[model samples]
Target chain A: MKVPNILKKTVPVAVGLVVLGYLTLYFVINQTPQWIPENLTRLARQADLLENPEAKRCFECHKEIYAAWKKSRHAIAWVSETYIEDSENRSKEKCLPCHIPRQVKNGEKPQPRLDHRDDGIYCVPCHVIDGKMHGPYDLFSPPHPTQKNLQYRESKFCGSCHEKTFEEWKIAGVEDTCQSCHMARTESRLVQKPVLSWLHSKKQVGDHSFPHGEITQEDLAVTGEISGKEFIVTLLNQKIPHRVPTADNGDPRLYLYVRFLDDSGQEVDRFKEILAPQQDTALLYGKEARFQYPLTAPVRKVEISLQYKPAWSKDKSEWRQLSYPVTGDSG
Target chain B: MRTSLINSLLFTLMLFLIPLQLQAKDMVVKAPPESLGKYYPPESKEPKWIQQMHKMSGNLGGVFVNLREKDWDNLDKNADQFVESYKEASEMVPEWEEYFDLKAAKEFAAAAKTHDGEKIGKAVGAVGKTCGKCHADNSISVWTRFHWPSFHKIKITDPIEEKELDFGKYMGLLSGTFKGVTVNFKEGQYDRSQKALRAFKSRFMELKSTCSKCHTTDDVKLFYVGENVAQAFDGLQKELTAEKPNPGNFWKNVGILGKQGCKNCHLTHRSYAMIQERWEEK
Candidate 1:
C-alpha cells in the first residue's frame, strides 16, 4: 500500500502537538508559582515584627477564612481568661511559645511571637515563613506571594504547639490527620476576593474555628443500672481521637451527679464524682468511665446526669448535659 | 477527508485534557503522614488491696445472688465468706472501720443465722452499703490505677492567706495526731485521748480535700485512711459515754488504727518520686 506524503507528515505533527500540550498542562498544574509580589517583599521587611495587621491584610482577600479564624481558640490564645489562669497569671514562660508562636518549626519547638503576643496563634505564624505566604495550593495571587507547603497539609504543623496531642494522635494510629477531624472543610468557595472568584477555581476551604469542644451528647454513650443498691453509670468516650475532655493547658472535667429520690420524688441523698486531667480522671480514647454509687437510703428512683465542663469555666453552671436516662429502679 | 482527520485529532486531545482538569482540581500537595503506631495504654497490674477487695466484692455479690435464688445454704455460705472477708479486710486495714461499718458484717452474720430470705437480703444490702461506701471513694480499679502514679504529694497554696501548705506536712500532722491518741490512751487519760482523736479526725478531713488537687479524680481511695481515723474517734466517744471507762477497747482500736490505718497507705504509696516520674511520662 502506498502511503500519501501529506498523511505521514500530518500524523507525526499532530501526535507531537498532543504530547507537548499534555506536558505543558501537567507542569503548570503541578508546579509551584515562582512569582513573588513586590508588595510582599516590602511586607516581608517587617515580617520579623509581624503583627495582627498582617493577618488583617490576609483578610482583605481571604474574608471567610479570617472570619472563621477570628472566632477560633487560636484567635484568643494569649488573651483568654482560662489560658491566663492556667498559665498562673501568664507567669508560665514555657506555655507562651505555643500560644503566641512567631515561627512554626518542623520537629522543633515554635518560637514565641515578640510583637503580636495578643493575637495568639494568628495567620502569619503558620502561613508566612521566610517572607513567603505558604498554603496547600500553588494558585495565582496578584496582591501577595504564595507557595505550597506540604507541612500545612500534615499534622506536624499542629504538633509544634500540640506536642502531647500530636504524640497521642501518632499513638492513636488513626489514618486521619488533625485537619481531617478538626479542620474538615465545610464549603467549596473561591480562595480569593469576589472579583477574582472567576479567575480561581472553587475549592473546599477548611473550617478555621478548629473546634475541639463541639462534642454533642451523641458523641458520648452512657448507660446506667442498679445492681444491689449500687448505681453504676458507664460513659464511653466515642468518636474522638484524644481522650474525652482532653487539653494541653487546661483542666477540663466530666462531673457525674447521682440524685436518689424517695417514692414521692423527694431528694434522699446525692453522690458526685469528677473526672479531670493528670490525676488520671480522663477516659482514654475508646475507654469507659464507670462510676459506682451506693444508695444510702431506700430510694424509689435514681437520677444520674453527666455534665462536661470545658477548661475555661469556673464552675459547671453551663454544663453540656449528656442525654441519658441514668434513672434506675422506679417505684 | 481533511475535516474528518482534524475532528479525530481534536477528539483525542479532549480526552487527555479532561483528565488533566480533573487531576488539577482534586490534586492535594500530599497525603497526611502515616500514623506512628497504635496507642496501647499501659497494662494494669491489680494492687494487693484491690485484689483482696475484688474477692470480697465477689463474695458479697454471691450472697445477694443466692438470696434472690432462695438458696439458703449457699446464702449462708456466701454470707459467712463475705463476713470473713470483711474481717480479714478490717484486719488488713483496721483504720477503715470508721468509714466501713464493721456492724454491717455482724448484721449479715446474724441474718444468715436466721436463714430467712427477706432478712438475709436486707443484711446483704446493708453489707453492700458498707462495701459501696469504701468502693465509692476508692473506685479507681486496678486497671485505671495503672494510668496514675502510685503516690501523689500535692502542695496547696492559699493566695488570699498568702500561706503555702506542703501535703507532706499535713501527712506528718496526721501521723502525729494518731501517735497522740495512742500515747494518751496508753496513759489511761481518756479525756486527752478523746481530744487527740478529735484532732486526728479534723486533720484527716482537711487532708481528704487536698488529695483532689494532684489527683485527676476526687474519687481517690486513701486505702481506708479516712475510715480508720473515724473509727478511732468513735471508739474514743464510746469510752467517754460509758459509765466506767474501758481502756482495753480504746487501746485495741488505737493499735489497729496506727498499725493498719496509717502504715498500710504509707507502705502501698511509698514510691512517690518514682510514681511521679512514671505519671509525667504519660
Candidate 2:
C-alpha cells in the first residue's frame, strides 16, 4: 500500500484544527455569561416585582430537582384546598407571605411575590438572593450564576416559614437540624438526565417530598383499663418534636372514645374526650395525656380507641384511627 | 478543494472540543456529619452471660411453640432450662438482675405443671415481657444503631391522603413502643408489656414494608434483622393459644428470641454504621 504525501499532510492538519476549535468552544461556554430567557431577564431586572420567572429558567437545567419540587407541599402551598379554606379563601394577607414568599432574607420576614403567586415557595424564593442563586455548595452551573451561602444549609432557612416549629425545636434541645431529619441525603449521582449527568457530580439530593402525616402507630401509645369504677385511658407522645397535632395554622385534634359493651356486645355507655390545639388539650412532644371516666354500671367489656382529625371540618368527616382498639374487662 | 476540506475538518474538530473545555469538575464535597452518635460496642469474644441470655431466649420460644403444639414434655423441659439460664445470666449480671422477674418464671413453671394451656400461655407471656423489658432497658442503645438509619431512608407518599409519611411521628411511635415495653415490663404489668411488644412488632413490620419498594424482596428479608425476632413472637402466640402449654420449652424459645434472634441481626448488620462512617470519612 502506497501513502500519498498530500493525504498524510492533510490528516494531521485536520486533527490539529479540530482539537483547537473544540478547545475554543469549551472556553467560550465556560467563561461567557449564560444565556437567560428574555422573560426571566426582565423579571430579574425589575426591583419591585417579587415573583421572578427565573425559577422556570432553572428548571431547564435542573430538571430533576424541579420535578421533585413540583410534587412537594411547597409547590401547592398557594393552591391547596385546606390552605385556601384556612386562609379565608386566600384573602388573608399575613398568611400569603409565608406561603408565597418572594425571597427569604436572613432575620427578615419574607414578603409575598407581586406575581406568579401560584408558584408558591418556588425555587427562586429560596435560591435567589439579590440576583444570585444561593445554595449549600458553590458548584459550576454554566446556565446560571451560583453562590454558596451557609444559611441555606442551616435550619434557620426553614425557620422563615416554620417559625413555631423552629422555636419548638430550639426548646427541645436536640442536636438534629431540620435538614438532618427532613432532607436526608443518600449517596448517588445528582442529575437524572444523561446529558446533564455527565456535567454534574455525585452528591446528595434533598428529598423534596418532605415526609409528614404518616404516623407510626407505636409512637403514640394509647392504653385503657377499668380500675375501681373508673375507666382510665392514657395517651403518651413519646417522640414527636413538636406537639402531636402540630401546625402553624391547622387545628389538628386528637379524640379518645370509650364505649362500654354489655353481655350481648351492645354499646351501653359511651364517653368521649377531645384534645385540640385551641382547646388547651394539645399534647406537647414527649408528654402524656390521661382521661378518666366514671362508670355508671357494670359492663362486660370496655373498648377504647384513639382518633386524629387533621383539622376541623363542617362536614361530618370520620376521623382517622391512631391505633387498634384496646379492650379491657369490667368487673 | 483541498483548502475547503481542511477548513471543514477544522470546524468539526472545534465543535467536539467544546464539551471537554466546558465540562465541570466532578465535585467531591463531604457529607454533613450525622447528628446522632453511631454506637460501636467494644469488640470482644462472646461473654458467658450473653450465651446464657441466648439460651434463655431460645427456651422462651421453644416453650411458646411447644405449648401451642400441645407438646407438654418439651414445653416443661424448655421452661426448666430457661429458668436455670435466666438465673445464671442474672447471677452474672447482677446489676441487670433487678430487671428480671424470677417470680414470673416460677409462676410459669407452676402453670406448665398443671398443663393448662391458658394459664401456661399467660405465664409464658409474662416471662417474654420480662425479657422484652430487660432488652428494652439495657440492649436498646445497641439495637437502635442498626435500625435507626433505616428510618432516615424511608420515604413514601400515602395513596389515600396524598401526603408525605410522617417519619418523625413514625420514629416517635417506634421509640415510644420501645420505651413502653420496658417501662411496663419493669412495673411487672405483663399485659401492658405484651400490648407494647405487639405494637412494636407491628410498627417494625410497617417500616420493613418500605424496604421492598427500593430493594428486592430477598434483599429486604436478608437485611431485615427482625425476621427471627418476629418468629419468636409467633412462638409466643402459639404457646399462648395451645391446649396444653409447656413452660420450660416456651422459656427456652424466648431465650433464643433474645440471644440469637436479636443478637444475630445486630451482629449481621453491625457494619451498616461502619459503612456510613466510611462514607463520612470520604
TM-score of chain B of each: 0.38, 0.36
**Model 1: per-residue Cα lDDT over A1-331, one tens digit each:** 9999999999999999988976664454335334435565455353333333556766777888888899998999889986764454454456767888888866568877667677888888887777667877776555455677778768877888777568767766778888987888766553556544544556667888887646666677777777776778888877677766665545566767768778777887665565655334566777788876666566776677767667666455434443323355532
Full-model lDDT, candidate 2: 0.59
User: In model 2, which runs have C-alpha deviations exceeding 4 angstroms?
Assistant: A1-51, A188-196, A311-331, B1-282
The 10-residue segment with the lowest total lDDT in model 1 chain A: A317-326
Query: Which sections of candidate 1 miss by over 4 Å?
Result: A1-53, A188-197, A315-331, B1-282
Q: CAPRI band of model 2? A: incorrect
Instruction: Please provide TM-scores, in order, for all candidate models, with all chains considered together.
Output: 0.49, 0.45
Backbone N/Cα/C clashes per model: 4, 40
In the range B1-282, model 2's lDDT, one tens digit per residue, is: 544443443343333323333333552223322321221111211223445666877876676567556688998898788788877766654445676788888887777767665566556556656666555443533334422353333343321222446554565556677566557655656556656665655454444333333332344444453456567667755553455545564566566555753455557554554444455455
